[model samples]
Target: MTDRDLTALLERATEDVVERDFAENAWAAALAARRHRRRTLLTGVGAVAVAALAVTAVQLGGADHPKPTPATSSTTSTTGGTLSDGTAYAVMPQEGTEGQLRDFDAGLPSTIDVRARAEAFSAARPPGSVVAVYLRADGDDLLHPVLVAGDGRHVLMGDVDLVRTTDASGNEATPLGPRAVGGGGRYVVFPQRDHVLRLDAQTGDTVSYPVPAQHVEWAGWNAAGTRIVARASEGAWSIDPSTSRAEAVPVVGGYEGTFRVTATDALPSDVRVTRFDEDGRPLMSTPVRGPTWSLWGETVNTETLAATGAFFDQNVTSKVIRRGYGPIYQGLLVVEPSSGAAKVLLAPENPDGQTGRVKGCCTVLGWADADTVLFQSLGSHGRWVLAWKTTTGEVFEVARITTSAPDDPVTPIALNVGRRS
Candidate 1:
């Protein structure tokens, strides 16, 4: 069939079938039967005929037709009700009293009101013995404080220093060498200055290991206190404390993305670009610039992974890659950073849906584990409370820890980040 004839047949086939009718006469049937004509045209014209017809349709304003507006329902608000700050706030469970838990801005100074009465103690160290320290949180009881202090030398949790040795008096301080403060008040005082010290804050007991000072820098640690990323003067290394050995890996350069220590050794070999071969076969080409590293793990049982990369286009923006198990437990979950919002692309499992705005000018500060990510939301009063997200992209409440005594006045919660639409 000629090109014009095939085009007309295809166009008619795309229209409503009920709209077109024909008489029972043979010639009339032949003119009305576009389906039968299509089969004959497709068989004779081949692939080039299809491409030409598509191009013609686009040129004739066919492809530019507006799509039907999708139907949508009201968004069900999760835990926290929408606050006046343009951010959402929710109340989480606390071990203390019911009023002990309060909602505050994750991006600004907020007061943590505690009704319990308790005594507070402060720890002091001699000049050269300690370098620097900061407070983490202040609670009515002694456990949660807002201020956390640490130097490249030692980490102090509450009234105890992970690296310090006490005299006859009950005191602690860092002897100095290289030490890293892991979560849960645990410190890995490394194989430095001839000893590795593991001190128990509750009992004030210390366990010392004898090893050579191999030079240490802050390598990120996992929640289990097993997987740790440390950079020595030699190269990039990961030490699994559970196995008591270090493995050397290539230096992955770029924005520091969240890392996880897996139960098995499986990570993506490399990240490259999407390209086409000379014969037009699709392939992945080597990355021209930016970092090529796996953010998530590679094992079949692996639950989550996150990585950071830079855009090569005009804006030259930075972005993060997060892949996790989806809500329904089918495929992976992905999120991309674009302009002012995070574009979440669900894997094959989700039927392609997007999320509303997740407010704040934030940078991922740390990862609690494979399931939770902590982000530092920048706002007016310095760095405020951090924001955390579950593997399924669900956000928890904003927790504000106090830096002073428990009786001190609390600051107002700042909510500047807007919701996504």
Candidate 2:
């Protein structure tokens, strides 16, 4: 930009200059140089003054200076007739209470039986008190995901319909099917009847953007969850719930595959992986090698697998490859390609000698950002939990599904960067 344009922008940025700015001199010098380059006869005095003012405002935490806070992915809240933020979630008893849920009815359709399924099919997470989803079975084959949560004492439930669907021939239709839910900061985004549903995780309030076509088959918030993008049989479109606009993006890679990603220097390096030809022929063995099951973080260097959350108890057969799978029963690792170095950050709290199942379980869900990775652990026979790990090795148990105790039966719960409709 020209010096004059730059000056204007800087002026807008420093409208609230103050005394606390220690960088006043720096801004002045920078502006003085720009003014000289522009060949302006005006004395540098005015530019210098503005620079000094801007710096002071910066240090004083003016409106131009916004504080940065750690990003919040999701939060669990209860509705005691209303949401935590005093939004009306419950009209009578807020509709979803332990008693009301016990005496539940979605009133979906006589064809859709919320009663029988209420007794036989139910799902929860965080062991007993967090984000949950359920399916109400009926005479129809249709099943939609419902958001369920509790605050230790009461169970809050809400209706979410999955009316958008696709046939085997890629035909779009409005019918009940499995629904996919993606969470963003302070809210949850999902595909609803015929629109993109944005639900406030805390307030239980909702806003929706109409689907761009007859049936939007897939949808998700950009990495930051600040915006929503969806796909229909016609094509992919980006949606802004805040503005209620949907626009078509590029089709070569499909806008449906795109998401706003966090900026990161941590690249998903081929250095740590093996590349094989289409026929399964070994092509390239990289610096850091992973086993049969491994995940690579997303592109743009914003985030990739920093390391695995679990340990594989096995000896390295060779620097190039590890001969067999050891049950990753311990967990996985993020391997350093440079020296084939890896750190086992996740392991079972209580190690089992024999009869023990793998902890630090399942695969990497996907990277939320450069420093974070989501995963699943199904070691608990009756329960499977979702977890997240940061580059610092701090792990958090986010949600889980409760089930009958069996030898690690497949938990319906799953985590993913993206799952196409």
Q: Top lDDT: which candidate number?
A: 2
- My TM-score estimates for the predictions, one after another, are 0.31, 0.39
* Residues 1-421 of candidate 1: C-alpha lDDT, one tens digit per residue: 1233222222211100000011111110101111111111112111110000000000111112122110121111212222222211221111121112222222222222222222232334311111111222333212221121111122234443232222222222212211133333333232233334443323434455433234332233322334443333344334444444443333432001122111111222222322222121233322211211222211110022331111111111111111321121111112211111111211111112422111112223323333333332222222223333322233332333333352232221111111100
What TM-score would candidate 2 get against the native? 0.39
RMSD of each: 26.8, 23.5
For model 2, residues 361-388, the per-residue Cα lDDT tens digits are: 3434433343433343444332222323
Model 1 misplaced stretches (Cα beyond 4 Å):
1-197, 208-215, 219-229, 236-302, 307-372, 386-397, 401-421
lDDT of 2: 0.29
Candidate 1: residue 272 Cα off by (Å): 8.0
